[model samples]
Target: MQEWQNACQIAAESAWGVTTDATSVQSMAYDAVRDGTSLKSQHAILATHRVADTLRSITEKHDRGWDAPKPRFTSPTVVYDERSMSFLDDGTVSLATTEGRVSATLRLPDKKDGYQQQYLDDEAWEHTQSTLHERDGAFFLHIGFKKPAEPSRQPEYGTVLGVDLGIDNIAVTSTAQFFSGSELEHRRRQFRRKRRRLKETGTRSALRTLIGIENKERRIAREILHRVSNGIVAEAERYCCDIIAFEALDGIRNRLPAGDVFHSWAFRRLIEYTTYKARSAGIRVTRVSPEYTSQRCAECGHVEEANRSSRDEFVCQSCNARSNADYNAAKNIGERAVRCVQQSTQRTSVSRYALKSGTVTPDEGFTPRDGGVRG
Candidate 1:
């Protein structure tokens, strides 16, 4: 793996040197340097492919008027295609190396219903490319698979559940469930203080500790996101919702305060995690325009800046409706989602809005049906 990494780096540097600009990147002959490496022919070809991909990415950024720098591969990782790697019948992985082919046992979790077993037992999922990398003095292999996506459900007859992401709270649902961000913020502050102290020390040990701290922080954040996303999906399922709606995050960072810049990535990641999880549960996820969602009154359709009394409080000036700020925003999001779908489908006879209790309509305010309120 080390030899392959070095060879790939050298080949990529050579490819970078030969290619003058973005226009010539596609037509450039990357295969000319294949014979110059000690790696096997197939591995050498894959290295060139990696180099071409990197060059293409860099060139694409440059084309977009961004000052992107050339990429350098400092980490040791080996990319493998179908021809260079195989899963043997004996439950071992055979990989091509500089010293010829080598085989290793592929370790997996013991759980019978684990993701690895789920994919392995299903013949429909086809294995594709993979990457082998080292971390924490241990080697790990990341395998990719592909399967046909299920058909998406129509939004016309769907029950929508709106989700509002905010700095004060990690997430708020139209159903009145809240995932507070206070604990997360406290942990972040603790990590920040520790990092600052370590930086001030300025020693080799401190540098190593910093790296460990960063990794730990990332793990904690990932775990928290996974939990939050799981809760979001569970809430949708609890309400028998078919569609989960979120505000479009086109310029969320610009809208957020300068100190809350870091939370922008968390917001995006939460949406991504929820989308996949909801899809797995036969639910559809969609995004609606975020314009005036916070300022608009969910109860009376009134739009005014003063509707939001504070960060956590919402008081409608027109209708005197009172509710949590995040909950009101989530309700507006759900209403907008329903309106958008109804307009797109041209269903003028009846328009339905999803609420915590049940579906609501213009004619009936809130009627009880099947242990839930319907309008």
Candidate 2:
């Protein structure tokens, strides 16, 4: 894994500042393969293609008027597709290594609690992509699978669950559940203090220790996020929620002062995990604009800074309503999700009538029934 990561780092560094095209970079990868870089040709191509994709993403973000910085490649995982890797019925994965094809038995948690066993046992699941990487002192293979299609049942309660994500409290829900980040915050502070001390000492041992600590903290954070996201899915299932709504927080840090710190929080990762888990359980996730969500009062539709007197307190000046700021934001988000669905339904009806009358073509911005277009 370390050797593959080293190869990827070299490939990424070579591909950057060259071009934003995958095919072109892939040809460069072919050249590297011909030069016998130890890794298999397919592996080298995938690594170069990954770098190309990353560069393209950064370029696109910059074109969209974002001050996106050039991405650095320090340690990158080796991505393998079906052509390069195979998962057998016995739960063993055969991966193409530099030396040749190698097989590894995936270590998984207990099957009794429906952990990784579902994916391993399901015959209907199709392997898609996998990543091999080394973290701390362990090597892991992260695999992706696509399950057979099933009819998704609509939410029985016909209600949307609004989730407001914040740094202080990881998540606040319309159902009045708060996922606290107090412990995470305390640990982060402790790590920060230790990191500062280590940097000040500037010893080789301290630097190595710093690396271990950082990795440990990252692992802990990911575990906590997974737990929180799972709890959210469970809550939605318990309440029979059809839709889970969240803030479309694109470029949010840029809008807020002292924003770099906000970037450290894994808000996007939390949303991603919640979305996939929700989808697997037949619930849809919706994103609403974050503008004024915190400031707007859920009770009276009051919009003003005064409505949020502090980070944690929300009081509406119009209707004299008070609530937890995050909770109020969640309620507002839920309403927005409901409103969005209503508007989409209206548009669908109009489009259907137009189509029947031959007044308009489907190519002219008619939204699909899946509700892909949103405000």
Cα deviation at 134, candidate 2, in Å, is 34
* Best-fitting candidate, scored by lDDT: 1
Residue-level lDDT of model 1, residues 1-375, one tens digit each, is: 666666556666666746533224323433444545567777766676676667755644553345777677778798888888988778798988877888999888778656886776688886767899999888798887766442222334456788888877888998888998886777789999999999999999999999988777765776687788889999887776777889998745656888775588788878887876786676778888999999999888899999999888999999999999999999888888777766675332124545666665533454333665322
User: How far in Å is the alpha carbon of 268 misplaced in model 1?
Assistant: 1.2
What C-alpha lDDT values do all the predictions have?
A: 0.74, 0.69
The 10-residue segment of model 1 with minimum total lDDT is 20-29
TM-score of each: 0.57, 0.52
Worst 10 residues of 2 by lDDT: 348-357
Candidate that would win on TM-score:
1
Q: What is the lDDT of residue 308 in candidate 1?
A: 92
